[model samples]
Target: MGLLDNLKAKLNPAKDKVSGLAQQHGDKIQHGLDKAAKVVDEKTKGKYSDKIQTGTGKAKGAMDRLAHKDGTDAGGATDTPPAPPPPSSPPPAS
Candidate 1:
């Protein structure tokens, strides 16, 4: 294999492990990101609120992609919609 191919092969396992961890801990990771953003915003006295919000959104988007929570299939298309809730049972007669 070429140097790039060899490097990719060596890193593939680590990448997979990281992806799995991201999927498992996605909620916690997102919470941490929000908390950190809040702390930074507070420290800066809201001076960079807009910038911080933008960065935080981008970070969350990246996390979702990493965790496969972005609704994208293996083909990279998001054509599938979320499943609907089951119908509720009818009320009993009086």
Candidate 2:
């Protein structure tokens, strides 16, 4: 098999697992998304409000796709906007 196909084969199980989890916790997941977005917006003092809102929407849409494979629209990609990486804490030493 080609490299891409081999990688896909290995990831299939993980995709399935994510889908299952999404289905089971779809509502809860969406709720968490909303909560997180609010917190992020608040922390950033709304400087990147539009981008943050758009990202949260896209993320929630992706999660919806994971939860429901019915091919329902996840809205358009036009709403997507550039986002900065999240603040990070230093990694633990090995």
Candidate 3:
């Protein structure tokens, strides 16, 4: 194979692996990205808020593409997993 072809062959496996992982964990990954952006914004005191927001949006879009390979939503954007229920309080004695 030519140099370019050899390089492409070597990178193809890595690309496929990344694609598979993205399909499996895209939503969780996007959520983490959003959380990290929030933390960074807080640390910078909103100085880079606009840029952070843009990055976060792009990350989410990429996540959507990875997770939705079939061009249909796979519970990524519209269906955020529900948070755990709050703990129940003990009842008072009668």
Q: What lDDT tens digits, residue by residue, belong to model 1 across residues 1-94?
A: 8999999999989988988999999889878977887777777777677777778877877777777776878787765443322222333344
Each prediction's TM-score versus the true structure: 0.74, 0.69, 0.63
lDDT (Cα) of model 1: 0.73
Best by TM-score: 1
Of candidates 3 and 2, the better by lDDT: 2
Assess the local accuracy of residue 61 in candidate 3 as a C-alpha lDDT between 0 and 100.
64
lDDT of 3 at 5: 98
Error of 1 at 14 (Å): 0.7
Candidate 2 pairs with clashing backbones? none
TM-score-best of 1 and 2: 1
lDDT of 2 by residue, 19-67 (tens): 9999998878877877787777777766666777678767876786666
Alpha-carbon deviation at 75 in model 1, angstroms: 5.9
What TM-score would candidate 1 get against the native?
0.74
Model 2 poorest ten-residue lDDT run:
82-91
Candidate 3 clash pair list: none
| Tens digits of per-residue lDDT for model 3, 1-94 | 7999999999988877887899888768866886787777767777677777777776676665654553545454444443232222223243
RMSD each, Å: 12.4, 9.9, 11.3
Total clashing pairs for each candidate: 0, 0, 0
